[model samples]
Target: MNRSLSIIMPALNMEHLVGEAIATTTRALQRAGLSDYEIIVLVNTSRDGSHDRTDEVVLDLAKKDSHIRPIINHHFKPFGLTYWQGVDLAQKENVMFIPSDDETIEDSMVGIFKDIGQVDLVVPYTVNKKARSFKRRFVSRAFVILCNTLFGLRLRYYNGTCVVPTKLIRKVPMRSGSFAYMVQVLVLLIKSGARYVEVPMGIKPTSATASFKIKSVIEAIHALARLFWDIHIKGVRIKIPF
Candidate 1:
């Protein structure tokens, strides 16, 4: 059976929250009258016993619904690799990336399903900014400003969860191993003249441990520099057939 949407959830040390995240996402899809969908949980290597617990939970969920696929990666890879691997495994035409601890707002899910094939990309921005920490909020705002300035596109946010066409996303060559890969994907898509529709969504505050780290920040800066040089200096742009 062909599915309409595939949700790629990357998990690492989210034992306490992943179960609820999966359940809430499932419930949201059902409430939106969307049954033709699959949820792929990519469990990365975790030393905190989260891997075992997530394996158990996802197996139990999969028994109830065959659409839930849990993939365990013994060798830990970067977030981008895990996410794109799940995308490669997706059997649906439309793909969405949702972190294991964060679930998309029900209203936003419904809205995306309503406009599934109407747009090339459905970009969602956080509406409840006060719910996030000051540091997180500030970093997110700064990242958005930086991306817009560098890419010459006026976007409200660059790192939020979005619903994108699988084929179009696959067309964009991804080289970043860091979290900034999402930014690169969005920039390439925008540069390719991909049609976008923004939707307001609510995101829960990420935990400090799961949020930003010094290593990630440095990697992000490196990724941004590479993207700037390739796109602006070398005139590198993805050519989309759509």
Candidate 2:
């Protein structure tokens, strides 16, 4: 079968989450009635020996199902950003980005590929079923609000798994941005006038475990600065339906 969907996961020290992610994505795809999809596990080099574990998982899964491909995302200084590079490495017409740590969708959610229609991208909104702390919720909501109001691009969600077309994902090669690749992706798509649909995810884990540390703040600012420079300062305007 001419498989159209490609699942791209950029793993970084996700030993704990890798197994579940791979299992969930693959099983979900099969349950959705398309079992020929490819699952690419791109793990950045880490000291945690994730490389070995990844190899084992990918090889074993590949033996059972020929759709799983594993590769080490090697670099001297890891960018701490995989959402962009990971999908680009995929060899499929459609690319889905599911964070290794958070995000667990159902087989019905997997069917989004069939239901995607003419939309260029599909970004699912997360429902945090677990009662996370108040501080994390506040920050998450605040960030969404700031990005929407300040940028005028009301993207329903930002950080969870986002399924984008291969063409759109390829256009966004550079990982230089203020937040992570996703924020820049939002800005770029808004700049490119890409149409999108927001699917409400069933239950998402609170990545908002503790209060934001100083380091995380710095990374956020840097990611945002890069976006501003690329869009406004650099005079590259990618428009969206505000």
Which numbered prediction scores highest in lDDT against the true structure? 1
Model 2, span 1-242: residue lDDT tens: 23477877766666677777777776777676665468777767664533546555555666876787777655423333555555657777777766565356665367565545457777877675355567766887788887776566877777656677676666764574234567777678756778777776765444536447677678877777677777777766543333
How close to the true structure is residue 69 of candidate 1, measured as C-alpha lDDT? 91
- Top model number, TM-score: 1
Q: Supply candidate 2's per-residue lDDT for 14.
A: 69
Model 1, 142-208: lDDT tens digits are 9999889888998888777788878878877766778888888888888878888888887665554
Off by over 4 Å in 1: 1-3, 47-52, 205-210
Instruction: Give each model's whole-structure lDDT.
Output: 0.79, 0.65
Model 1 — TM-score against the truth?
Answer: 0.90
Instruction: Tell me the spans in candidate 2 whose CA falls farther than 4 Å from its real position.
Output: 1-3, 47-52, 73-80, 129-133, 177-179, 204-213, 238-242
